[model samples]
Target chain A: MKKIINDPFNFVDESMEGILAAHSNLLKAAEGNVRAIVRADAPAAHKVAVATGGGSGHLPVFLGYVGRGMADGCAVGNVFSSPTSSQMKQVTKAVDSGRGVLYIYGRYQGDMMNFDMAAEDCAEDGIEVQTVLVTDDVASAPREEWQKRRGVAGLFFAYKIAGAKAETGSDLSSVRTAAEKAVSNMRSMGVALGSCTLPTVGRPTFSVSDDEMEIGMGIHGEAGVQRCKLENADQIAATLVDYVAEDLPFCKGDEVAVLVNSLGGTPLEELYILYREINRLLTERGIQIYRPYVGRYACSMEMPGASLTLMKLDDELKELLDAPAETPFFVQN
Target chain B: MKKIINDPFNFVDESMEGILAAHSNLLKAAEGNVRAIVRADAPAAHKVAVATGGGSGHLPVFLGYVGRGMADGCAVGNVFSSPTSSQMKQVTKAVDSGRGVLYIYGRYQGDMMNFDMAAEDCAEDGIEVQTVLVTDDVASAPREEWQKRRGVAGLFFAYKIAGAKAETGSDLSSVRTAAEKAVSNMRSMGVALGSCTLPTVGRPTFSVSDDEMEIGMGIHGEAGVQRCKLENADQIAATLVDYVAEDLPFCKGDEVAVLVNSLGGTPLEELYILYREINRLLTERGIQIYRPYVGRYACSMEMPGASLTLMKLDDELKELLDAPAETPFFVQN
Candidate 1:
């Protein structure tokens, strides 16, 4: 209810308008569809195009990643709602080069359905399109049902690997393979200290007692595995890491990239504190951290929580992760 | 308080440990001084060193800027408290190359006094040191008493300009001049919807009615110029921009760099909506925005608010702003 917004009904459209205006130099609306955002210079000849899309609310996710070295375009949607198939098709067409286009996004029912429809449409037009669904939240499912897990911060790893492969002029199949590999090697889990409010609803999506925390909650306030008394940073880190590490079976001598992501409302100071405990636990297990990123890479709007993602890295994955990238919300050199 | 921290009294030390552990590749704690953080590859021969320090809780400030082509070092302090003179001297010594060091921080009494003492200490040790106090919060003082205003998010402009100048092998005096010029050209103001809580205090710093907002609130909950009914994003943006523009006397056709920074709890979606209106207002005034950066660049631990900073640019400042720099939290390439 305390949000600084104009009209709740027009939140998505108005937010996209603002984004396009502010990042005019780096992004533009698709020629015929304002819901689809593409890099200003898209369709680089003979290079595989990378595209992703999902609901609004998570900035730097679907749209913020559309840039020179990242996704070539993204289809945007209403808050907590997937973009329509038509919007996806428009973005796919806008960014597709002679090589093809790769579609990557979190594994949600609405998202999968819309993206599949768009892929079929693109195929009819002789534009090759492939899809990769990120399912890396270990707490969302058991190993036997890993494919049923929801994606979270681990999608960032998929984006980086796929974007790097496509930027190197790889074929569509190669980009898809890289993305799938990254997702398969990753695991994430989160604890929510508080809930986030939707602009339209003007109320929290869910609620918990002041002294309680929800473990394994989804980015959009999906019911988690358990709700328990609030614990300190070290305990929370241990619970998250224990679940994720066991799921991946990350063992001694394993090398990985660590992402300690805040869920919108958590401060960087607390994230770093959480990261400290995560680092200590990983070190005690003899796992090597190749590169650690601590910040709000992915988030739910105004949710007080944090997530930990570990992506087991091979030499190729490490190289791709270290490749130069520039975007409005993320930058690496 | 609903914070994920252990031992609130030791929050600063534990957070620093995590930061050092996470960014060990780019940074390291100064030898014999755990509170002093220096770039891993510090003391670049014959290059002016840029150092900054302030109270804790504001991540990405004070310490996050200490990396290649940004800041050479920083002195860490307790929550909302300035670093001691000994801490400042240790960091200055750790990063001082033959070219000397330039100290930059917010214009706060404790910070200024401690840094001045450190400067004298460095002088006796035969190390050249110059200081520039940032004062860009237009809401804190009248135009005739601008020097008394508190520094806020606008300090980031001073850091980027001075760091770029220092990286160019400029001497101490030249770097100091660039920093001073940047601070003079910048203006900022913020509105707070809620207050922030310190870990040790376990309570909000201040309070506001549910339907009220404090305009021009300081980063640390200092009283603002006005309190009124909370307005929509468009109206809020207009008030902030109008005040900042008039304070700078920014004329039509002027070029500037815009920073729409979050005070921790404001989501990017809301910030973008705010930015949308900011862009519209500036465009209507015929002001040319050179480049706009939007995110939580400087924050006050989970405070629900946003600040707008505009730095009028000259040819030199523009070039410096465009220069390449890399840090854990910020990167331009």
Candidate 2:
């Protein structure tokens, strides 16, 4: 109930204004739509324009990835809400480099409907636009119904691979193929021990007993698949690891890069603890780790949980992962 | 009192062991000193060696900086405790190429004494070593007694500049000078709204009322300069930003980098809120920002507070920041 903002309704917009001001040299505001964001150094010479959009809370994820070797542009919505079709169309035009634009976003209702409409709008304007829904979370649905699963942190892996191919000036078909490769090889599952409340909503999105943790909570405070008595770090890691392994069915000695991410409020101690167990589980199965990143990659606001993302890294994927990138949200080498 | 460690006494060691295992391809355990960590591909032909070390909790600061274009080696101590002199000596020996070693660490009594003794030990072993301490918090004393102020996140900025120079194979003296330059130009001030319980101690380092926050807190849950009633984000940012600006005597048209770091439990929303005020305050002074990083850079186990660091950068600092570097912890471009 207590905050210093001039208006709670304008929190996201005013915050973006400040962000653009600070990064004025590297970022710029899109014309017309307040929520539309594009790279200040846009139209990077004939490259396929890779654009992503989503709600705001999981930063650097949707917008932070808009930089060299990554997303070409981003459509940012209010916190936990999807951007309008008008905003999406603006991004489609802003990132267009005379080739095409690929609309990449998670599988959520509002995002799907608005982005779908935006695609039609772009076509009407003679701008070629293609869409790809990154639904890599295997916990939400069976493999046969993978398209219905919610997209989560694993979308980042797809973005990196696709963006690299796009930056190489690959045609839309090749870029799409690369993105699909990354997404198909990726799998993520999360467990929320607690929930996060949006800034405007002063109460938590979901709730569980202090001793019980839901095993498959969506990143946007969506209903979890199941809940059980709390378990130890090793047990939790084993649970998620087993699910991902069984779903993906990677053989022994397969190379993978692991991401053990905190949803928000979990401490580093807990992440490292989970990382320890995850490493043991994977190594015991003869998995070869290319690089292990155990930190908050994409976090829900104040949510107490962790997700495991395993991407089967190929040479191209490795190259993209190795690409040097910088943005307000994520910096990588 | 709940944690995920097997034994409280072995928490740091076990954590280090896990880190080594996860990073073994990039780092290794020093032969004689388990506390010292060296790059797996060390003694990089003739580059000057850069080594850093401090207590455990302020992660990604001392240990995470050990990679290409950063510290070549590091020594990690127990929670809020300094590594032994032997560990520092081992780190120096491991990193020492023919170009000598530069030692950079936060200002702490135990770390200072131990590193000094280690320098002497390295001297006996015919290895040259130089040292620089970051003590930039102004609230500990006025400018006349700046050295008495404890070091905090400001040290990381020093590390970036110094490490960049070291990566360019600068002489030990040049690297030391750049580090000192960064330290001299940097100023940081922090407040603590809560405390961090040491893993072994199993109790909070200090207590705070539900409506209070301590101003000018150091990294290791140390006492702050003043305890005051809790205020909104803008007021807190104003308090911190005013202190940092006044300490630096920054003027119009000055270009500086700002870091708003969360001390653990504070969410990104709060950090961003704090960041909004910081940029506003600096811009009002006609200052231009080169970079603004707001997140958990140096977290202290579940402690609730935010620290603001402002570094008036020179062309050289900006170039090094623009340089490409990669490590397990941070990647900069």
**True-vs-predicted CA distance for residue A290, candidate 1, Å:** 0.9
DockQ for the candidates, in order = 0.79, 0.37
lDDT, candidate 1, residue A137? 88
Model 2, B1-333: lDDT tens digits are 434445677777766766776777777878745579988888767898888898887777778778878788998888888999989888988888878999888787899999999999999999999988888887777887777767888877877788789888789899999888888888899888888778778788788887788898777877778888878777898988889888877779899988888887676656776787788888898988888777777778667788999999889999877676666677776
lDDT of 1 by residue, B149-243 (tens): 88999878888999999989888999999999999899999999999999999999889888999999988888999999999999999999998
Given candidate 2, what's the lDDT at residue B78?
86
After TM-score superposition, what is the CA distance of residue B36 in candidate 2 from its true location, in Å?
Answer: 1.3
* Model 2 per-residue lDDT tens digits across residues A136-211: 7877888788778889988778778788888788898888888887887888989888777676876677678867
Residue by residue across A42-110, what tens digits does model 1's lDDT show? Answer: 876679999999999987677888887778899998998899999999999989876889999999999
Best by TM-score: 1
lDDT of 1 at B182: 94
By summed lDDT, which 10 consecutive residues of candidate 1 chain B come out lowest?
B25-34
**Residue A256 in candidate 2, Cα distance off native in Å:** 2.4
- Candidate 1's C-alpha lDDT? 0.90
DockQ of 2: 0.37
